[model samples]
Target: MDESWASTIAQVVSQEYPAAMHHVQHGPGHADPRELHPAFWGSYDWHSCVHMLCSAVKLHGRDSDLGLSALLDQRLTPYNIAAEADYLREHPLYERPYGWAWAMQLVKVCRDTRWEDALAPLEAQLEHNIAAWLRTQQWPVRHGVHSNSALALLLIFDASPRMRPLVERTALDWFGAERAYPHEWEVSGHDFVSNGLAEAALMRRVLPESEFDAWLQDFFAPEAYTFYTAPIQVNDPEDGQQAHLIGLMLTRAWLLREIGKPDGTQQLIDAAAAHLTGTNFMATHWLITYALLAEDALGN
Candidate 1:
């Protein structure tokens, strides 16, 4: 990663606080965002905060900058993480699949066991939720955002190993027989994730390499893959929902890289570069993490 990008990520994760906090008063007392999630109260919302933290930690691992390390330590205190865990206990459904996935990813990135211990409460809550969801969810959610079960399972499998069997079972049960996905029904104005691509990414993790390749061949027609290689247009980057197209670009790059299909790599890279050319506050606050994730997937 470039030094400038790393610096920007550190700055945003550390200083971009106090906007886009989704706090709802559940009872007589109203809690502030910071009060509810002391460690993860920045970067627009809880899920973003968690993923941004994950990005910062990941970048620090690659760069080994003292300043970045200090910033992480300053913000990721045991007290603050405990407060975050407590908030999850209070509002179990808050950012259910999205935040829960990122929280587990955050745990995966934290090198310190102390940080892991601090995050135990939140981890426990998310694990419980995942198990419950697997048992009850009869159908997979196809949306690209928070509700996408495949996306959540992929994250869980990445971050939490114990949940692998359940995630694999649930994913295969929901998506094993899927074929000829409808590519035309995509790029919903607010979609940040490609449901079809996400499912392929998740299947890659659960199935053997040969099986996944066969499954991929059966699941997406060549035209559908070609359609995804072209980036979706973002009519208005300033519009928070429309800005999600940038995320879709990043995620597409990630999926392409993970699938290792050389045909689409350059197109995915080009699309990602185009979407990343400009920035808006709404997108800047959270989109870089997805960009970094794509780069990671591509071994950059």
Candidate 2:
């Protein structure tokens, strides 16, 4: 939220435009990510790059910082973003729900910014793709990982009221029946999001307050959810796989705030803050976006 954090995020999202490109080149001619995805070819992957760009839009909208403004102007141009849309059109299910969700969030956050028009092409593409996916996909990917449907739908639910009805219907059908979550079985080593927590967070947005309270009680089974009371620790921050747990702490903090678990939110935020020092590229490449999410949700 400060100039220092802005600088760090700018550095991470822009530093390696062509490095670590995670593209599944399906019968490709040229495998270069910069030419392929000129707008979102950074921050390791498409979704991370998108959410970080979302952060840029939000920061610029808030403070009108000249650096962030310049970044937005450079990357969020109609020419570059339409190229991103063109790429997505070629690969319809490229990022599927996760990256699509962040793409929508990016546009949603850019509503009042100057970049809104630039993102519209991609936004329209995602609208058609995600809507079709929501209607046809019968199952939710209820994992604490990139493919998780609940968290992505949760992001979509917040990104627009136009998509809310579809998101709510699909979310209820997929996750409404979930109960008796085995809290201990949650959070695989490389997971950054908690499947159980993301489901609850989505349901909270869809269900009424009293219904959600009852659903929460049934989902956790009286007192089985103390696992998240403390922040998850990453034993090896340098390991790319283990580094995901750093994001887990930050995401859990915001979702905790969403589900009215204030007692644990501070603990998670405090524990996750130490890793945002810009020292570890494994953590810094994408964790600041989630840290900003926690900071906003906690009103800090």
lDDT of 2 by residue, 206-275 (tens): 9999999999989986454467866776889989789889888888888877888767577777887877
Best lDDT among the predictions, by candidate number: 2
For 1-300, candidate 1 gives per-residue lDDT tens digits of: 456556665656655455566666757985666667678876777788789878878877777763577767766887887777676777767777878898889888874634566666667777887787678878988887878888888889989997899999998899999998887898777888889888998999999999999999998888887787786666788787888887887888787777775456565556556444334557766877887877788662
Global lDDT for candidate 1? 0.77
Q: Which stretches of candidate 2 lie above 4 Å from their native place?
A: 26-30
Question: Going through the candidates in order, what is the number of backbone clashes in each?
Answer: 0, 0
TM-score of 2: 0.94
lDDT of each: 0.77, 0.82
The reply for model 1, stretches above 4 Å from the true place, is 15-18, 28-30, 112-114, 270-279
Candidate with best TM-score: 2
lDDT of 2 at 202: 94
What lDDT does candidate 2 reach at residue 69?
Answer: 78
